[model samples]
Target: MTTPFGLSSTATTNTLVLGQKDLEIIQPPDDAISCLKFSPLSIPQTYLIASSWANDIRCWEIQSNGQSVAKAIQKHDAPILSCCWSEDGSKVFTAGCDKTAKMWDLQANTFVQIAAHDQPIRTIHYIQRPSYSCVMTGSWDRTVKFWDTRQATPLKQLALSERIYAADVFGPMAVITTADRNIQVYSLDQGPTEYKKIESLLKYQHRCVSIFTDKSKNPNGFAVGSIEGRVAIMYVETANPSVDNFTFKCHRSTPQPPTNTQDIFAVNDIAFHPIHGTLATVGSDGRYSFWDKDDRTKLKTSDVIND
Candidate 1:
């Protein structure tokens, strides 16, 4: 199928064209790929990490030819739902239905179950900066917990009213999405001592499905996506003494279609471009569109991926 924006190709290519283009899909192992993270270092040798619904974590080396070939890595009994590479790309962290978040030593090719979450862990991220090296996790248990990777127990757990679907660590703040249709932003800089909820925005019926911060624009601000096909730009406002001061502006809305207008169909994943200030969203409808901050117009729409 072809659209006005660009053509969709199923061919696998080792090279990325100067402009936006489709990546060849190298059939991932078995089961569905639940999460994907690319090494921040370089392209080929950098590595792409994928966690699966099949209780597996696989690392594929970006070959010299730009092709991805899966490397056998750690295997677990429960599905690996979410995974992330450390800031320095030295380690990998994964959370899963096994109810634990494990750390992988890339250099040693070993796995260590670092912290156990009460429920199926949905997301895990490592916070590394000038002052600390810690891990944060959000779970179906309706809570977010911070753990000192060096310790056996969690440093702090913030109770919530809904199950957490996803979370991201940015600088000193952590942005979390809940099943209750709220995006809860928390401060990681406060450590375990005291955590005041930074911001809570109620905007959807199916939870904030995805959230991504623009690494190039306002690295501190982020965009939230919900199941109902709505995305809002959320920014942290720390001036207020209590948390939850963060505010949001609706950036894009899935068109109540048949209107001959293009919009996000149903956001499944979102990523900020490597250089541009554009935010890319991939949806269940296989539409890939890029948008700017002001939400003025859909900047670009490229190839669509049909599942």
Candidate 2:
């Protein structure tokens, strides 16, 4: 079976290679899992962290034998919508329905809090440079805010036209997709002032965004997914720009029996393998797919997780 590490396993005793029942499974939270992220690639051992709508957060160390043991878990007052790790893996940032963003000490289990928005936060991300680190958040409030590690107040908050549905950062550039079907890009170094809005269609509501970072220090393009099962592979016009911007259909829905209509589902998440630049996407259909972006090809699609 294909392990999550992007490798095949020949070992018969590997639990991750076994059926779901054979693997070490953490007790699931009462609600849906909202986000899942791995520990920093620089770390010796990989850890999988998951936050859920049950107002719970948990982390588990991924064992070499494909098993896992819980390392930490905490319960909050409200459901957590998203979570991300700090640059050094020393802190975990979580945002939720409570309209607050919190920084948790990974080892100590203590936390500091910030009132981030008037509406529930939908996403949170952290990126660091040699000189400074920043945590960014996107909210249903139709705003994206950036906070420097040293300050409690946001350095800047940019007003988005519609509710922020998805946002992502790669190096100095970031992309924000809103409810109005606007896909906007920003320069992290330029704070909230420098941004460009891409002119796209009004058909699909963006569900997720991911930036490509393998080839260049500052990659020019990003991929965004929509509720209609399409993915937009967009390139900016400057560093400043590029010409190969396009969008395609992927993770399509199935037609209902005796009806022309099909069940539409949201693309839940998108990520590029750090080393390979291969893109992976997960959808509400419970299927996961792989794409070779450089080749503009669909590499493979897995059966629904339940199957």
Candidate 3:
């Protein structure tokens, strides 16, 4: 299907292709993409939403044949930095350089300002628990705010030492990375208070982070990526010395036979498979790789694509 932005390829099979032999290129935003999120598992249809530097958010419904249909588009005053799908996949939450966060209801086709910060909202997430539900927004103003959509003001706000670079929340655990390479863990069950704080293992600037469950289906560990082409696997429970916490180098190119030098690229993003728990990392090298964190091995690596 051809869109106003670009032409999209239609796949023959129902499976979605990414960095594989048969790739499907959908309509892209006018500027660089800052964030991309897929619909929650509860939703039957696969919907992808992307926030871009062009100050707009675009949603696409993935068809059975890997075709992407433009579902919705919402504009913002400034570049959108991040976006996420609600637990039920019925709504989307976005935050950006405009210092505000907005919620988009897919069913009603409406947008509402849900939260605000003093500085650019860099990251956002929707948190839903049996006892409570709210939107989490992390901003460059060095604060993390939780907002109840029904009310105008934030339900809770947590101040940090430095500006937030990235954050991720899973189950009741929240991991936040700041500008100074400081990592803080929060327990939602304990009311937004700081649970434990740890210094990052990587020496370079942190880029992205993701939470993954352990064998018991509890979120006890998380992956942190840095600009130095490294990922650190950390566990929340450090009391157990038996737990394996390690860091590995990736997204780097080996030098030729005559030279021992290597080219290192920043690890742009890291995500763990919801079902299998395997991790995937995308980098500035234009390559993505899947890894088995427990086994400490790369499962698959995709060919470099020319962007």
Candidate 4:
């Protein structure tokens, strides 16, 4: 996988390889990579997190040249499905099949189990604020909850009919997607207790897999990826009516894969380049493709991760 926000092109057929100029192999593991992230402010240093079906989350430090340069950074008791770093890069947030989300303080080297959802936590994002920051989590319970990092109790919660597939916060808004094939925008204006639904639509009839805000590009524009392997770009304008203000445009998917690559892949997650609007996509088939948000064109591709 392309380092979370870093850049790499791999050409591995069965092995994860760094592809632009030539082929380079990434270390092979017994388990598949469940999630990946790049270190904040760390250039060319990326973390590859793998979760085993047996309930294990393993972290590997990868160099720009496609080598697993260090030992696993950490481990968890249950199968980890999602992982994210604090906005300041000081801590890490993780969710697993254990039905709980944990906060890890790198400075303290301690892990604290925070809250237990009704089901496994699927996605999470840490919001950075000048005064205080918070972490938001999405679970299979069909609800999304916000938790204050300094406190263990949930600050607020919102319910939905279908299980939540993805959730992330941007500025004062949190965007959530559910199995109902709809994306709901919730406002944190009055804290979670009085959440006002800002937007609701079935942008994708298929399960929405990833949602990300392009704060670096346009403050109000964000993107979402789906199980059908399609992506929709949206712009959130709060000036409009309550839930009818935002407008979204579905970008056409790249042309079908070459006949030989029919089984090519699907997107796992999308993260905007910290400095630019370029998008990094990790495919289930293991190909890490990069696209320019402005033009929505493929910029680069990497080898498939070993599953």
* Each model's Cα RMSD: 8.0, 5.9, 4.0, 7.1
TM-scores for all predictions:
0.77, 0.86, 0.91, 0.70
Model 2, residue 25: what's the lDDT? 46
Which candidate number maximizes TM-score? Answer: 3
Ranking by TM-score: 3, 2, 1, 4
lDDT tens readout by residue for model 2, 1-307? 5443333333333235235444744554667899988888766787778889899887766677666656667666899989988867777888989888888786666777854789999989996755556888999999888887568789878888999888888778888888888988887664544568787643778889998864655667788888888887877764523447667777767666787677766788999887788999998888889998878899998777752
Using lDDT as the measure, what is the rank order of every candidate, best first?
A: 3, 2, 1, 4
Worst 10 residues of 1 by lDDT: 2-11
Candidate 4 local lDDT, 85-190, one digit each (tens): 8766657888878898887765565778876798988877776655556778889988777888667778878778788877666566677777776667665545
Q: Can you tell me which runs of candidate 2 are displaced by over 4 Å?
A: 1-24, 190-192, 238-243, 254-261
Q: Rate the local accuracy (lDDT) of all candidates.
A: 0.67, 0.78, 0.88, 0.61
Q: Which candidate, 1 or 3, has the higher TM-score? A: 3
How would you encode candidate 1's per-residue C-alpha lDDT over 1-307 as one tens digit per residue? Answer: 3311122223244544434553453656588888888876732356888999888887766655567655546877799988998876768899999999998877667789888877899888888757677888889999778788789998788887788886767666677777766666666555633333434343554333333445444455666665546665655654542442233322334456678554534456767664665777665665667777545457776554445
What tens-digit string does per-residue lDDT give for candidate 3 at 193-285? Answer: 788997678999999999999778899889999999999999888775345888999999977677678999999999998789999999999
**Clashes (candidate 4):** 10
- Model 4: weakest 10-residue lDDT segment is 244-253
